[model samples]
Target: MEAPLITADTLVALIPEILALAFIAVVLLTEVFGSRSPNLSSGLAALGALALAGSATVLLAAGFEGSFFGDGYVVDGFALLFKILVGLVAFFSVLAAARWSARTGDTGEYMSLILAVALGASLLVSGRDLFVIFVSLELATIPSYAMVAFDRRRRESSEGGMKYLLTGVVASSVLLYGLVLIYGVTGSANLSEVAAAFTADLSPAALLGLVLFLSGVAFKLSVVPFHFWTPDAYQGAPTNAAAFLSVAPKMATFALLLRVLIEGMPETAQAYTWLFALLAILSMFAGNLFALRQTNLKRMLAYSSVAHSGYILAAFAALTGPALETAVQAVIVYAVAYAVMNLGAFFVVELVGEEGKSFNGLFRTQPALAVSMAVFMAALVGIPPLSGFWGKAWVIFATAQAGAWVVVGAVIINSVLSVPYYFGVIRSMFFEEPAGVGPVKDGSGALRFSIYAMAVFTVLFAFILGPLVLLAQAIGL
Candidate 1:
């Protein structure tokens, strides 16, 4: 086939994503030869990369639509918005992992994987074709499996890594099968073509293909019925890895889902609404209820992440014109907000083990860290005066507007149910006396900054939600 017309406009539009890949290459080369401590090198490279990606993002946003190699790759408002979000998330995650890298003495490889994962996430956000999306998802996932077991000294980490790899493989295969079905039905792998295919026919075979495709999407998003791997993986992975895992993948996956469902399968919405509605309810209830029983902070947040997936799904099920746009904006903003809060919370928890003690006695030893953790926990619970509440409020508003009242009710009820578990961390911190086991040391200056930054954002997210909502609408998403 003649090479699709490549235009300057398209190349400019994709500069952020293209430069992101280039940054990864630079990091890889530096790691290959730079004599500096790998940890320092990795940290600096990761930070520099995110900064470069941010600049690219600004450039792309300043211009307009650009397509590459025919209709294969798209640079648009939707892609730019998600690319920025993923870059920010990856940058923060690298910051969170800095100390962990230093301690493990494996900073170079770990940091390199982080850069690679970020590149993958960027690809996922920008993907316009099924093949590209699947490849990008693998790009993100493979590095994470290694990160999970980055510290070979820990058996739990190894187990977690194994479980993550095995489960991820299964999910990937299932998703691929679904994608193949779409390709068969549509005779095309482009997302837009798949949606057109849905409208062309209403056959059992077509419906099966649609359902199968959605199942894979559901797995990636960690929606109900396919979320069994989440908690174990979260609990077992290194804390920083868990934080990265929790935020970055979800951001890209959701963006991919939005593009595919809304743009690629608009005609299937009416038929698929109920299925999404049911998944939303189950994910919320199951995640929230299970979270209530968890004592491990990482595991609790894992369930909380799962619950948020339900909330997002509920919004999707309830989507209309501007409602879909609003909900998606809410999802992206909330992803950023959650990344900060969750990573900060984990950072503090990691500090609690500073004096060679597990994070069991946080309240008595480190009151300030405890309080910051409380803010994060409260935000996660959707309490008023915090960003989490507004994040959830927009989602609920979108769901209600879509007329998915049942789904809305389920989300509200789940949010209520979620409060106790989220607050359970706070309760452990302030309400109950610390175990008084040992001294609690605080985090490094960088960790402190991360925590404070997240706390400030969690506190201020509601005020910012309005503009983000406007930005979302402007995108025509």
Candidate 2:
């Protein structure tokens, strides 16, 4: 008899994803057969995320590692870092949604979908095979469709979701084509094998596959020219959903990018780095410039997300050097900072409203909330001693050290360009008079608590900057 393909160690390494699936199953069953307590459902989802993060961290610390299913899946420090990131995003998303979830009721499916996205994100960060990446990417993406349109009662939700799905389909198709071309050229779906087969001089088909595959990844990362879907989706999706989508998918997709570029396609780094540089420059200018015209807070932030993508890519553009690991670590740290500040900002939008005017006189009404928003906005502006500053500082340090001066310039210039609008938010909150009573819309303690926690991190993250770098080195790309 043939030995089992699955070993005991495989199961142990798979614990995080398994836990996500198990929670997903329980969530669905509860929706179908159990009582309809929104708290229970959301609580379970949050708890599951907590467990997933805890498990991933434990595995990372325990030095657990595995490659399973013929190298299609693997677990290592890199994957665990993303798993931990995804879990934190999911958990905070639930906490952000707690008040809204409770008030709206029927959160079973909502929480279930979040868990499903989390599970797929976990899978995506571990994929080492073309087929595995595609499957995991879809699993991570499909649920987001429903999530964007979760407010089926609203027309914008439907339209945004439809546009998202249609455009997403095209991106995915293009991605699939690229994957198929690479598979055909290389005759293997395994990334490591494919990389080993590639040479400095590649076939036309291989080059095309490389470009197309990157385009698809660009769409996921919201790189400019591929980011048209972002503002519409954020404007249309529920605020909480926007928060989750902004962070989770991007982080996972970035992990995939690191795997492909660093581990799977180092031979193609010259071309890839050049492309990333071009895209990074374009994304920075376009995202910042366009954001200047948006009066809606969500749209502005959507554009901000685009700009931040460019900042991270500025660091990523430095992946050409011998010190690739340091570049990769910079990208990861930037992602974490982006997640924290963006989530904090969006959670506030969730609490108040989406209109830029929503923040008018916020300081007059709620001091804590206003102060928190200030920290987040300041961080986004890359002010010193905040998380955003640290994120930008590291990116600048790493990119400059790698001699990617042009990319560093773009990041700095764009940060300056973003000042007017970002600080415009602050001025409105502190300088303007309140339009009405009870400026806060949600009134949920959960939302308040979550927002406060994120703000705390945004401010105190400077203290943890050292650990983040150490953790990146310990886990690695």
lDDT of each: 0.74, 0.88
TM-score (C-alpha, index-matched) for candidate 1: 0.93
lDDT tens digits by residue: candidate 2, 1-477: 865789898899899989989998897788789998887888898998998999998998898887999888989888998999999999999888777766656588888888889999999999999999999999999999988988866798878888888899899989989999999998999998889756668899998998789889899888988999999998899889999999998999988988988777886874567678889899989999999999999999999999999888887777876658778888888899989999999999999889988799999888889999999999999998888998888888888887888888888888899999999999999999888773545447778888999999899897777888898888776
Per-residue lDDT over 125-156 for candidate 1, one digit per residue giving the tens place of the 0 to 100 score? 77888888889889988898898877777788
The C-alpha RMSD in Å for every predicted model, in order, reads 2.6, 1.3
After superposition, the stretches of candidate 1 with alpha carbons farther than 4 Å from their true spots are 1-7, 36-39, 353-364, 435-443
Off by over 4 Å in 2: 1-3, 440-443
What lDDT score goes with residue 399 in model 1? 78
For all predicted structures, in order, the TM-scores are 0.93, 0.98
Clashes of 1: 1
Sequence-dependent TM-score of model 2: 0.98
Q: For each candidate, how many residue pairs have backbone atoms clashing (under 3 Å)? A: 1, 0
